[model samples]
Target: MNLLEYLNQNYLMLVPALWVLGFALKQTPAIPNWMIIWVLLFVSITVGSLTFGFSYEGLINGITAAGVAVLGHQMVKQALLGSGSRKK
Candidate 1:
């Protein structure tokens, strides 16, 4: 089977897994927050392209996946911790 077919079939699993990874990265103190976001974006694009035979569609999907992850993380944090609380 081709990469697109595989991606279509497995995106449900893949996207969430990538999102969780981004969330975990956010918790690590070794890397800055901005760097974590960029890293996740880069990871999404690279992984998607490599897994799906490299295409514009793959790139777009990767970016979307990363955005979903980041947004989800922020939403969860805000909901659970309240917006007024700063981590620093």
Candidate 2:
């Protein structure tokens, strides 16, 4: 099954939007490092809710979008950086 099947088509776009927003936040000195995830979560839910109305699907999609954004970023980062520990 397509992994994105779990999310609404509309929500899929949020994944990359979140990445851009996260990157922008990271560049801003006023935002704290620890708060980025929370900010993303809040934006995700708010945007989802606004797009689809306040409902179960909206909440789920918001949470899922944030997850996909974060997961995708980690996958790319890990691939480029490799494992933290080197083989003996």
Best by lDDT: 2
Estimate, for each residue in 1-88, the C-alpha lDDT of model 1 and write its tens digit. Answer: 2334333543445567877777688788888877987988898888878887688778777777777667777778789988579767
The residue pairs found clashing in candidate 2 are none
TM-score of 2: 0.87
Global lDDT of each candidate: 0.72, 0.91
- Model 1 ranges with Cα > 4 A deviation: 1-10, 83-88
RMSD of each: 6.2, 2.4
Q: Which ten residues in a row have the lowest lDDT in candidate 2?
A: 79-88
* CA lDDT, candidate 2, residue 56: 93
Model 1 steric clash pairs: none
Instruction: Work out the TM-score per prediction.
Output: 0.72, 0.87
lDDT of 1 at 6: 35
For model 2, state the Cα shift of residue 70 in Å: 0.6
